[model samples]
Target: MTDPNAPVTVTPADDMPASSAKAVQALALKHLYIAWVRFQRRPESMRSFIGYDLLYFPPPYAAKWAKPFGYIRQAASTIAAIRRHKPDVLWFQSPPTFFAHLLVAYRALGGRRLKVVADCHNMGLDPDVPGNFWMKIPGTIPALNSFDVVIAHNAAVGAKAAGLGVRSDRLLVLETRPAPLPVDETAGDPVPQVILVPCSYHDDEPIEMLMEVAARVPDATFKLTGNLARAQSKNYPARAPANVQFTGYLSAEAYTHLLTNCSLVIGLTTGEGIQLSGANEAVGAGRPMVLSDTQLLRSLFGDAALFAANETAPMAAAVQDALSRQGELRQASRTLKDKRERRWRLQAEACLERLVP
Candidate 1:
């Protein structure tokens, strides 16, 4: 995260010829016509894909009494978008318990012509706890049956989907992969001391634990980046040690710069569904990581990461170990980066072919 105190500057894109600009604009329009349908039951918020012209369906409700009606309104809006956009593919991030029934409605209304894909980022439920057996309720079962394709973020999630009766051919395991680190390694001396913790500061997140660890590792400065408004509104703990700084929201380039220079990365999410993009970015940049002992983290990093139990003492120890053996960790990080790049490229190609063919 850039120092909030530092002066921010705007840089223009390199000059492009008139012909090239026109060609690029035309290509964007063609892709725009081939929209990707997304069902966002939550209120308008800055998610990762905010810039994309994907359809959003915000669940309605100001009071607890109107929750059910709000969901119905959102589902109706989702159906309307599907009919209007008629996207080649219907991609859902995950099935929320309150809105899973909407999938069945979409399939019935949109018909079999549109391909339905469920991108499973976690096991069919919350991350910290094992999935509730009752999630196999009838409402969820039919919704799972509606998808033409199922994409899991990891092999474990793929297996879980299969166990829930999704066919093997329909399931695609696309592991979270990091974008290539920028080639310009011109970050100056002393590295401006930064450590990034990216994720929502929700209750399940081990924010307090991380804060304790940060307090212990005073030498390595820490920076927290994510939805700061939500954090503040939700009353998330604001007592981060004096050394820790918060960067509300950052542009892609700014965040990437911090990741490149940061000495280490730390994540303490408990959700099995939590995919650690920052961890992958850290690995790509050959930086050491200290992560919580969640199933998703274990599968993604294997033995490459320094893992600790949720408690503060163990978490602190893991961070210390990562800092101590930084060299070995950096080498392991490079190996993971190579493997992820190849896997993601292959998966992306396959997805594009399926969409455009």
Candidate 2:
């Protein structure tokens, strides 16, 4: 247990255990740390935690398996990070996969002083990506108990985490935040040929339904982003139709450009504990949204979004309706700006509150 009397410090790292490769860590060292360097230059320094410009120390050689070797090496770096910074609370975002188990092992083996808060960002059951029993304890859901608090982005995910043994009080529900995306109120006019769908192509996304929707709404083209691999098609057994274009990975400028100019942004996700980044982007840019009927999106978007059942015919109808009610939907999207603008601050403040005096 962390010492209550000790100096409270909080820090967030892109610490997804499963995917934290040396190459990925290098990006954090360069991009994330470099951004911190720039932020500190302005003098109104963030008060919660004192961290080095560089966040992660990836191991030199990549190992092939998960066990005492790969697991212990990753845990050691995280342990070392805690000891060096001596944070009362360390906020690790996502993948209860390895890190959560690591923390449990750390505490049982040696670590006890730092409080671990697992920010279960986009955390869900993820039936598609089965955990390897060969990896010793499968996925990260079992690691929820180690954390003092389990932060979930949506209530559906929070409930899932609760089912995994995280106490109710320990579960904090933070909404999908509004990003610093470019906005264009009068976008997608005259040449409204695009309907943007932002997805990671996970199993949770119903690609067959998307294909059917595309065929139904032939007037507007569907542009899907997220650089998601087409191999995910193996999950649905349905290929994307002709009108649907996959631009794959997009740069920040390109993403903003696309979102700003797109006619309708569709959040056609099929599960919970996920984000509609594309829908959020559409809202920011004052573009109408056709969202999947999930409690989370409904709560955030309210009447602003055109709610569609996660099916072919209904979703297609919703898309058509959005096209017809473009003016009203645009107004609704603009109204969301007030809500979206405050999200980043609210999320930041909520996290900061955990790192108290």
Candidate 3:
């Protein structure tokens, strides 16, 4: 049984076993990363290169009324973890931007000499723009501006932080690289599969358009992953082709199996300046991809994925093209993984340099 009193630390990424220990020893900085959420692959993978000891504190209760109490417990636990670890560099995942506010208060009141950094996601960077009332609380921007360094997913997100008064040099652009899930040893499904990962069922994703694509390609199975309720609440199609299947809310094991066995992974979004976690997953698994054609996606994916417009015809065409050239696109994905991993190392190292005295 896991000990409730003990501090929870992240295990090293399977792909980069030496990353945490080696980087910490070479840099001579003890780094500790804290998050209020259950789990996120971005921080998990980033810790592999950045060598930060991860401390995850998932909320204690599910009830909405208990959130305030949950935040109080989380704040106390965060302070306890920091005191126990005594890291020279403290990194916090913001949007719970209040955690950063708490850290700043902790430094001011407690007079701790720790170098504070924030890994700001899009919502955290601009809560006002997203209009997420819970996150658009007072001091959101000021707390963000107070961080010693801000790690952004891309230059576009970093610019938002800068506009809010964070110093330019202190803002670092570091994209997410999802760690691959371990595929089962058993044989894959006999029918060819194409996965479409729409995690949030947001406005930008063309959920209805997927039905059109599935109709066009009747031979290959089309599986969509994420919450069924959210999809249904949105403009999701009531009826899809026989080949279209919704693998709603998959277990980690099932998700890994489905992603690994699929011939192609398609994650299309019209949202500007956002990076797709699904695209990163495709790269991690070395699966062929069909992604939306946007500046951010095109820049990050390059020749690795088939780019398509959000319309039915173009998306269907791209899906077909990726399915036909699975072998070639799979190899390209592997190659892209290598190139991105190398780039991530440099980017992580550069961000670390700013933390050094």
Encode model 1's per-residue lDDT on 1-357: one tens digit a residue.
Answer: 332212122111221211333323322221211111222111011111111234434334556589678767766666666566555556665545334466676456654366565655463533333434335546664565655656666776666667767676567776665545652344332344466787656655777677788899888788888867656665544677887877876765677678777767887777665666668777767777888898778878874788888898998888777777766777777788778766664653444343332
Q: Show pairs that collide, candidate 1.
A: 122-273, 127-271, 127-272
* Each prediction's whole-model lDDT (CA): 0.59, 0.59, 0.74
Name the regions of candidate 2 deviating beyond 4 angstroms. Answer: 1-89, 106-115, 122-142, 186-192, 231-238, 272-275, 340-348
Q: Candidate 2, 261: how far from true, in Å?
A: 2.2
lDDT of 2 by residue, 220-318 (tens): 888877634443445432376778887766764677778777778898776654556566667667888888998778877875998978888889999
Prediction 2 global C-alpha lDDT: 0.59
lDDT top scorer: 3
For candidate 3, write residues 1-357 as lDDT tens digits.
Answer: 343334444434423533444444434677788888755667766765556688778889766689899999999999988888998889888777678778878888974688888887776775443344535667766665676778888887677777877778778888876464543334333354656554667666777787888889888878887767666666463676788777776755667677777888888777766778888888887888898888879998976999988999999998888777877887788889878877777677667667754
Runs with alpha carbons beyond 4 Å of true place in candidate 1: 1-85, 95-100, 110-112, 123-138, 181-190, 229-236, 249-254, 271-274, 284-286, 294-296, 324-331, 345-357
Error of 2 at 43 (Å): 22
Worst 10 residues of 1 by lDDT: 41-50
Candidate 1's TM-score reads 0.68
RMSD of 3: 4.0
